[model samples]
Target: MGVYDKMGKVTKATRSRAEEIVDYVASKGYKLTRIWGMGSSGSEHPTGRALDFMITGPGLGMVVGNLIASYLWKNRKRLGVKWVIWDEHIRSTSPGKSGRWEDYRGASKHEDHVHVFFGTGAYVAPPVAGGGGGSAVKVVDLSQLIEAAERDTDRKQGGTTPGAADDVKIVEAALKAEGLLSARYARDGSFGSLTVKAYSKWQESKAGGSYRGKDSDGIPGRKSLERLGKRNGFKVRS
Candidate 1:
């Protein structure tokens, strides 16, 4: 059967971008079990600019949901995507800040579905400033980072000793850059629960179309850490 077979009856209308997203997913041989296009007042769904792919499958449903989210983020410009929310995380294609998967603390955690919003205008890339000489890229030790996180039971504000959480600070800064952690907690240098949760979300964003529960265990892994470092102008030494 085709992808439409899995989609239940849709009561409300949808925009072109939402339809394109469904077509793209179907082209990739993926199935979206259920979809809802209408919402109550003050929602984009009623205006046909938003849709919720109520995905249900084996495991946490994060596998297929992440695939859809990542695809939408990567080709957002062409797809006219405003933002994507799934599994308690949200990524926006905003003007200045794009591709930062922040922790979504909305009313709905969106643990079981992937929500997408489309913009009316064409996607515009943020202006990049000119620079002459490039500075040295910072390096973080993954081993030390994992060790600190493992022993970070206090989950407090700062570190006990000076520079004790330096490596963690580096990673936290990266996470903040990705919008996963807020600025208030970005430089605390503590691998606490919040930081762990943010890192776990980051881990879940990768691997194309696979569920990554083990990798998203809030522990730092080499491959995922390296990817983060590469994106944020840092080097990871394991």
Candidate 2:
């Protein structure tokens, strides 16, 4: 393909980054090759701003360095960036490149490419196995927590997070809601599979109710919430 060949699309925010990365590589005396490109903001693709780089000519991932990782690890604090895997089911922070990288082992498809995320760095790791609060005791803004619950994701794409919570927490809460013999809710607030399933169920249950939540794509919408308010003896507007 020509240089004009589309490697991938990206968020308008990353345009500078993408260009900088590409230019950085080109500056190294290498040619841009075809790489698997996903995420789109231009072509005006749906979803939020994102970049898709389809590097080719050379084998995939033949770049000089792990650009995304480098950015995350190096500038994590400066850029206010967070960490997720290149291709793993679970969303988590890298433990300084040597920690246990977690994911949804069975149903993950990030095998080919890594996903560097931005815009919403809202996932917190779940509390360790013990009852001790430790880092998990931190109070999360319920509003942000609900927003994470509303996101939908699957084999097609990674979940879009307005605000991400710990995948572990999401599982816990879903299980909590589900209780024994049922999947629990992700109390930690991370939107994992269990939470997604639970959210889907909640949305379905509310569809016909006077409280239609959001677009009901599983994201909590306003109507459903207002009804919840009324149930709690709070006034609800039509």
Candidate 3:
């Protein structure tokens, strides 16, 4: 068996899951900057159930990092993903806390990679589809998007609204494409002051020039969102 993070043999399940993650990233046309498995003694790493895939790409890597996190979360049960950490936050498959991205108090902010832990059930590797499929266009929910944005704005610093990361990330991706938001902050799934400022700039642009003053207050309006969706590959659902 191959060495696990230069320590020793990892469980079949852990090995399979780690391979799948790497393959998945490759299929998306991006590469993981680095991967670590089975090191820390008290953690899942030593037990061979944890893996850390450092993210890097065209722009500081956060975009693909977000994509990987989203994919793992979406397929948590199917892939036996027990827990995940990225960008200073954690999400778990545990009851009452599933899908909730809460602040991570750990020393590592995890901004540069995605840390995943799989349950024992991930023994047999799932079939990994091949080829570089560009980023998938997510279907954005307008109500949830607005709610998430408003809730995020209430925060004094970086934080995400519950159940809002995916949708917010989609919106942020659109904003980034418009050159309004920096890639570094675009994929973290937060709609803080920076996102608000970016959205305002988007509204003032020619494409959304119809909005003015209160209408262009940075909270995405139906028309402006629709227009953005048209240009971005996402569909806005009301």
Most accurate candidate by lDDT: 3
Candidate 3 runs further than 4 Å off: 1-8, 56-60, 124-238
Say which candidate scores most in TM-score: 3
> Which of candidates 1 and 2 is the stronger one according to TM-score?
1
Candidate 1 pairs with clashing backbones: none
Worst 10 residues of 2 by lDDT: 177-186
Off by over 4 Å in 2: 1-10, 27-29, 34-45, 59-67, 78-80, 87-100, 104-111, 120-238
Native-to-model Cα distance after best TM-score fit, residue 149 in candidate 1, in Å? 1.1
Ten-residue stretch with the least lDDT total in model 1: 122-131
Q: In what order do the candidates fall by lDDT, top score first?
A: 3, 1, 2
- Local error of candidate 3 at residue 54 (angstroms): 1.1
- Provide backbone clash counts, one per model: 0, 39, 0
Cα RMSD of predicted structure 3: 17.9
lDDT, candidate 2, residue 213? Answer: 47
- Model 2 C-alpha RMSD vs. true structure (Å) is 17.2
lDDT of 1 by residue, 1-238 (tens): 4333333333212333444455556667775655666553337766656777766753326677887888778877765788899889899887786579889999998888788887765322111222565345577887788877776746455552334487887788667656577657776788888888888888887531122877688788888888777666577886
